[model samples]
Target: MTIRVVVADDQALVRTGFRMIIDARDDLEVVGEAADGEQAIRLVRRTSPDVVLMDVRMPVVDGIEATRRIVADGAAARVLVLTTWDIDEHVLGALRAGASGFLLKDIRPTELVDAIRGTARGELPLAPSVTRRMLDRLLRTAPRMSAPDGLESLSQRETEVLTLVGQALSNAEIARELALSEATVKNHVSAVLRKLGLRDRVQAVVAAYDCGLVRPRRP
Candidate 1:
């Protein structure tokens, strides 16, 4: 199936560039484009694309709010946030708002295409250096200290899956490491989120760290 994408950025050139790059690939196509978050949502609702490449600093509305509404509505479209700064707080907000992942504005065309593909599969993108610092600071600033009631209900296996998510493992990679099928890993991850009352994997990652289910690597 072709991966339909919606490109939403204030700059017409950026959106056009992304559309050309994505549409050039056999697996991807730009179904629609928008200049701001509000328009992006409307386009997403209209097209129901598989993914959205959203800029964090758009006018009228920001990407974080748009992402939050999209996920909250349980739309099928995934969000891939774009930012100019490394470890920008808005990046965290976007993720917490249900973005599947993020990309640097200067990311190579191939990498950008790959990020869209990965996010459609519910996987995180390639921002390990920036992401690591973001996750660490998030772990410290997060207010999940009291622990949600549903979080305590996770089983041992479910807990493990959440920890791996916190460590940034994709479902396929998690399956390989745990000697399980990708479907099974996905199941566990889903159950973990349901039990934790989380919005998506990004929140799952934060929950794992906040609950001390995983530790960050020392820099």
Candidate 2:
């Protein structure tokens, strides 16, 4: 299936550049483009794209509010925040506003394409750099909420799986660590997310760090 995408950026050049790369892909299509956040929201509502590439800064509305509106309205389209802002506040704001993941604008074309696909597949495409920034923010700030009530329902094994997920390990890596098949690891990951009412692994990671289920590494 072709994943439909909408590119929203204040810069015409940025939007055009992304459209070129995305339209070149066999499995991806640029269904629409927006010059600002309000337009982004309107395009999303009209086109219902599978994914949205959002820039944080814009003249009207701004990406954060646009993302908030999209997710709050229960749109199926996932938002992948692609902005030049690599700061912790922007990353946290986007995630809290229900972005599927965050990536810097400087990401390679191949990585950008993969991230959109991953977001469409209900996976978080958080970059390592973004993750590091997020972790720093998490360590310094209190969680937005105690956690979803479903967190208390997780089994011990499921909790362990969530902890590994917090570390950003793939299912195969978690499987090897626990001496389980990759399939089993995937199951655990799913259960963990379901039990916690998380939208994706990115939220799971934040929750784990939030509730102190996983501690920050001593670097």
Candidate 3:
């Protein structure tokens, strides 16, 4: 399926550059552009892009808040935060606000295209270290009253699959580790997602961390 994307950046150059890269891909297309955070939200609402490439710094609203609002509005769009480094201040906020992943601006064009496509399919671009860091940040902050409701519905085996996902393990790796068939792993992943009402693997990871199924810090 074609993945519709919204590029939200303050600099005209950045937006233009991304548009060129995305539109060049047969599987990806840039459906709209936003020069500021407010415009980003508006455009996303109007266009219903499958994924949003959000700049951390914007004129009126920051990408973090824009992501927060978009998520709160119950949009199915995935937000990929753009930052200078993988671990920026807004990176944590955006993830906490339900972003799929954060990518540095200096990433190669090929990787950016791949990451956008990944995000469109509910995948994350985060490394294990970034996932650990974001989970640590979440642990340090005030605990929330809830996790994404429905984790309670997961079976013991499904919960095991989700914990591995939170740790950034791939399907085959999880299958090998769990001594289960690859097909079984895929089914478990689907069940976990359905039980948690999450859109993708990234959200599943986030839910796993918040629910204390995975430790935020490595031992």
Candidate 4:
């Protein structure tokens, strides 16, 4: 199946570049282009793309708000946020706003394509560097509070899986850590998301930090 996508960036060149790359793939199509967040949202509603390539620094509505609105409106299109900076508040904001993945602008073309596909597949495609930075930021900034509603519903194994996920372990790594098959780990991760009402693993990581399930490392 061809994955429809909307390229949203304030810079015309960036949008064009992304469009060309995405359109070059047989399984990917650029259905729309937007120069700002509001336009991105409108395009998403009209085209119902499988994924949106959102720039966090766009003018007008801005990508984070656009992502929040899209998710709130129950749009099926998953958001893949692109930004220049790796560790920053905007990245966290995008995550909280329901982005399915985050990638730096310097990411290779092939990696960006893979990220879009992964997001469409309901996987959290965060860059490893971004993931580590995001977790560190969360530890410093996110409030240490009670678990979000529905966390207690998780089985013991599910809770274990969530902890591992929060630590930025991939499904295969989680499987290795727990001595289970990768498929089993994926199932547990899915269950954890469902039980926690999380949009994706990004949110799961936030929840892990919020609830103290994963502790910050000592200096």
Candidate 5:
């Protein structure tokens, strides 16, 4: 199936560049383009794309607010936040606001395409550099004060899955670590999300950190 996408960035050049890369893929299509968050939201409502490439620093409404509003409005499109700064707090805000993934602006074209596809598939495609920094900040700022509500609802296996997810491991990686099939790991991940009342894997990651199931690596 062709994955429809909307590229939302303030720079016309960036939008055009992304559009070119995306449209070159047979399975990907650029259905709309927006120069700001509000326009992005409007395009999403109209085109119902599978994924949205959102720039965090866009003017008027900002990517975080746009993501929040889109999720609040129950739009079907999953948001994939893009930013130049890997450690920007706005990236975390965007994820918390319901973005499905985050990527640095300098990501390779192949990786960006894969991320878009993965986000559409409900996979969290956070960049490794960004993930470490984001989680470190989360650890320092949010700390593991207490378990998030609904955490206890997860079974032992589900908890394990959540822990791996928080560590930014993909389903295949989680499966390998737990000696389970990828399909089984996928089911466990779904269960973890459902039990924890998370919108997606990004929220699951946050929940994992919040519940102390995952911790920052010691230097």
Candidate 6:
């Protein structure tokens, strides 16, 4: 199935560039474009695209608010936030607002395309260089000092799986680290998310950090 997308950025050039690359892919299609967050929401509602390439700094409304509204309304479209700054606090806001993942604006075309596909598939696509710092900041600044009620339900093995996931390790990688079958790791991951009341792995990552289940790597 073609992955339908909407590119919402204030710059015409950025939108055009994304549209060009996306349309070149046989499995991807650019269904619409919007110049700002408000337009993005309208376009999303109108097209019901599988994914949205959302820019965080748009006028009229910021991407974080737009994402919050979209998720709150229970729309099927998933948001993939794109920004020039990888470590911007807005990235955290966007994630908390229900973005599937985030990408640096300078990401390679192929990576961007892959991120779009991954987001559509309900996978998180964090920028490699920013994950550690982002998670660290999330740990420090996330509002709650204690674990959420559902978080305590995770088993010890499940907690370990969640920590690796917060580290942004893929299922195969997690399996390799834990000496478990990939299927078992997948089941653990599913249980972790289900028990934590998270929407996807991205939220799980945030929760893992927020609850101090994962720690930052030393420099």
User: Which stretches in model 4 have alpha-carbon errors above 4 Å?
Assistant: 126-130, 137-146, 216-219
Q: Candidate 5: worst 10 consecutive residues by lDDT?
A: 138-147
Give per-residue CA lDDT, model 5, range 17-61, as digits (tens). Answer: 999999999999999999999999999999999999999998997
TM-score for all models, in order of appearance: 0.85, 0.89, 0.86, 0.90, 0.89, 0.89
- Best of the candidates, TM-score: 4
Regions of model 1 farther than 4 Å from truth: 127-134, 137-149, 170-186, 197-200
| Candidate 3 local Cα displacement, residue 201, angstroms | 1.4
Per-residue lDDT of model 2, residues 1-219, tens digit only:
999999999999999999999999999999999999999999999999999999988878889999999998788898888767555466677777788788788889999998998889877575544664556554555444466678779998998898888877777778999999999988898898787867788777777877677776654
Clashing pairs in 2: none
State the displacement of the C-alpha of residue 190, model 6, in Å, after optimal TM-score superposition: 1.5
- Residue 216's lDDT within candidate 6 is 60
The residue pairs in collision within model 1 are: none
- Per-candidate local distance difference test: 0.81, 0.82, 0.83, 0.84, 0.84, 0.84
The local distance difference test score of model 4 is 0.84
Candidate 6 per-residue lDDT over residues 1-219, each given as its tens digit: 999999999999999999999999999999999998999999989999999999999999999999999888788898888889766778888988888888888888998898888888877665534655555654455464456568778899998998898887888889999999999999999998778766778877777766877766654
Which stretch of 10 consecutive residues in model 4 shows the poorest summed lDDT? 126-135
